[model samples]
Target: MNSKIPKSIDEYIKNFPNEVQQILQTIRSTIQKEVPEATETISYAMPTFVLNGTLVHFAAYAKHIGFYALPSGNIAFQKEISKYKFGKGSIQFPLNEPIPYGLIKKIVKFRVNENLEKTKKRIQKKKSKPNHE
Candidate 1:
């Protein structure tokens, strides 16, 4: 693990090699295209985008770039992401192979919608709760 924490995604990407930086930038742009309103920040030591809540996160690794769209997004896009290596909430796109920018865009869009819906439900639930005094 890197001891030096990056202040921004640009700084994070700058630490990597040119090839890795390009892949990271592509992932960032794809996510931005999906959720232009989402706020960008560093969370969990990675590039995180938050809308209603944490929309998604991405990080560059030595061999692969990891995309974290939360567990629900992985379950929702199982068919597409199955082609690549994935964990509960993260997918690994290898640096040697072509990154699936299209699928990444879809996942980001899915996460944005999920976050929005969850936020809406949370607000509604709060509104319906009886006053405790």
Candidate 2:
């Protein structure tokens, strides 16, 4: 891609036009509101939200906004997300189409809870294991 890779979500959204920036910000804020503790960073040249692991990623394209919630998130919300164009783990919300912010919030919240549960399970598993000196 000829576009410059942004170092942060703010920088990434700043590169886009005003309308695109609004969409990107709304997506960012929705995710943030869902997981207030999640860290914001740039990964794969896109805006990435990280909790116990990667919660989600989003990028603005020429024609669409690419929202990635990983395979688990996609699988969990397959029925609702299937309406949009998608790949293995990502969905493309067209610029002209209405972006489903409510659905996105639900997905992000689900991911946050999922990640937290997984982290707790891992911790419990480790606690159960005997020390090997």
Which is the leading candidate under TM-score?
A: 2
lDDT of 1 by residue, 1-133 (tens): 3669899988888888888888888888888887888899999899999998898899988788899989998999999989889999999988889999998888888888887789899999999999999
lDDT tens string, model 2, 1-133? 3477878888888888999999999999989888888999999999999999999999888999999989888999999998899988899999999999999999898889999999999999999999999
Instruction: Please give the RMSD to the true structure for each candidate, in Å.
Output: 1.5, 1.3
Q: Could you tell me how far off, in angstroms, the CA of residue 86 lies in candidate 1 after the best superposition?
A: 1.0
In terms of TM-score, how similar is model 1 to the real structure? 0.93
Residue 60, candidate 2: C-alpha displacement in angstroms: 0.7
Clashing pairs in 2: none
What is the alpha-carbon lDDT for the whole of candidate 2? 0.91
Report the backbone clash tally of model 1.
Answer: 0
- In model 1, where do residues sit more than 4 Å from their true spots? none
